[model samples]
Target: MNRIEQLLPEEIEKRSFEIISEELDHMGVILPEDEAMITKRVIHTSADFEYTKTLTFSKDAVAIAKELIVNGADIVTDTNMAFSGINKKALSRFGGEVHCYMADETVAKLAKERGCTRATVSMEMASEIEKPVIFAIGNAPTALIQLYNMMQTKQWKPAFVIGVPVGFVNVEAAKELIMETELPYIVNRGRKGGSNIAAAICNALIYELTRNHQ
Candidate 1:
């Protein structure tokens, strides 16, 4: 077995990023600046380099997301885990907040009455919010489908979307549907994302914004 090297508590993350960058370089995987930042963060979170290929971005998606974040865009997530994982304090600096309506009693009741998943109702509730919204979906394809449906009817428009739901059922289809739109989005092309990834992507963007502000 290889001996573990001594590392200070704070050095771990910095060293991890250094390793991620070196590996990406060794693989000849060069991403554009902002996209690279997001990609590296995703890879760091999952320790999966496959994200270099599986991650997709709409044109200027990262830039647009940054702009929205600077303007105080609120984020709506499909899962509480994702909601909890985001850097709330960092986002709050820009007057933004993270929301996960999946646990709301009203959402649950409405979903049962309408025979839809809580994700669907949660999205519906999110559409009613007046602020600029960014969606980070990591667990449910239904939420993406519902958002697409709402977009079709002109009932809702998100400033940006991170559509990375992980599953075999309808996950790929939902991601494809979102890609068909002109909306800005960061998505994983396959069933290879999770709530952790979604939160990581959000934090990545927020961290970038923090750097720009500083």
Candidate 2:
């Protein structure tokens, strides 16, 4: 087998990260520790280097996210794709758990009753978790909207929000709403994201924490 073919997926990913970082440097992108973590993962997800320029973050995004993970916080994803993409073992080392309630019957019923998207209602349900919560939204703008509304109400706030839903619907508007809030967030500006992007971002944070702690 060829060298590339012989390499395991994790090895290929590691080597790819090295290449991606080198390319970002050539393009004059000097990212901070946390920003690099998110940017690289997003690029890893979409293979779109443009994300290096498009992804935005709150001042304390990574720090706050790491803190939440270290505290065994629960991660809530907007879709099962994101939920399945996270590094559960790494998160579990810090007592964190990943959750996705999009398929729940109650969420469906609530969304229908409230005239809102199921993703939005799911966030309301996720907000009830007693421990710190991290929201990884990758499939629905409505979820981001709901979270932003909660941020306004002071009724619920997550340790961090990764809003990278991919679509042409209310995706852009929902992300814009999130930016207006004071919550720590890592958002892909524009409508180029999805559950994979969201999951990659979450894994990036978890991986970084695992690396830094080691």
Candidate 3:
């Protein structure tokens, strides 16, 4: 089995099979009594992609940021420290416009020095940004709720969201948000995946999309 498959717990594996079956049923993909084989195939298919990588935090963020730019992301939002760092290098290397949102002025200034177009913690500005924004949120559930509500009110339907909530608080929040919104997104599994992991997943998606496009 691949690394991801090995990482999957028995419960998650069972749950994934159920979800796949439900989705197939919804799509009218009828199947016979070969449910066990189908489940194995589903698990294998799910594990086909490599989602995470081990890199220095900065390198990880930069890699993801480049992918976002390539995939036509105009504005990149980093609500946490690690994302801010990654987004900074990405903005510099990609030389496109990027916006950094943070509660701390120091972080914002750092982001600015690294080539961010605007750095602020203002939700209003975020709400006003145009569509197809790339949102990277940390592990705070309250923050996720607020952002989601803000986007809903503004009618700003993001094209994609990269959720990498690292700690206990943010990880649960991220999972809940994913299950609730069902929006198109990429997420890291478990609390072990902090800002860097989230950035990496976003990077992987960007790379995947870019390769597919080319």
TM-score of each: 0.98, 0.92, 0.48
**Top-lDDT candidate index:** 1
The Cα error of candidate 2 at residue 65, in Å, is 0.8
Off by over 4 Å in 3: 1-71, 79-81, 84-96, 103-123, 151-155, 208-214
* Tens-place lDDT digits, model 1, residues 1-214: 3598789999999999999999989989899987989999999999999999999999999999999999999999999999999999999999999999999999999999999999999999999889999999999999999999999999888778899999999999999999999899999999889999999999999999999899
| Runs with alpha carbons beyond 4 Å of true place in candidate 1 | none
The residue-level lDDT of candidate 3 at 18 comes to 69
- lDDT, candidate 3, equals 0.48
| Candidate 1 TM-score to native | 0.98
C-alpha RMSD values across all candidates: 1.1, 1.9, 12.5
Task: Give the C-alpha miss distance for residue 138 in model 1, angstroms.
Answer: 0.5
Candidate 1 residue pairs in backbone clash:
none
Please report the candidate that would top TM-score against the real structure: 1
Error of 2 at 176 (Å): 1.4
What order do candidates take by TM-score, descending? 1, 2, 3
**List of clashing residue pairs for candidate 2:** 166-193
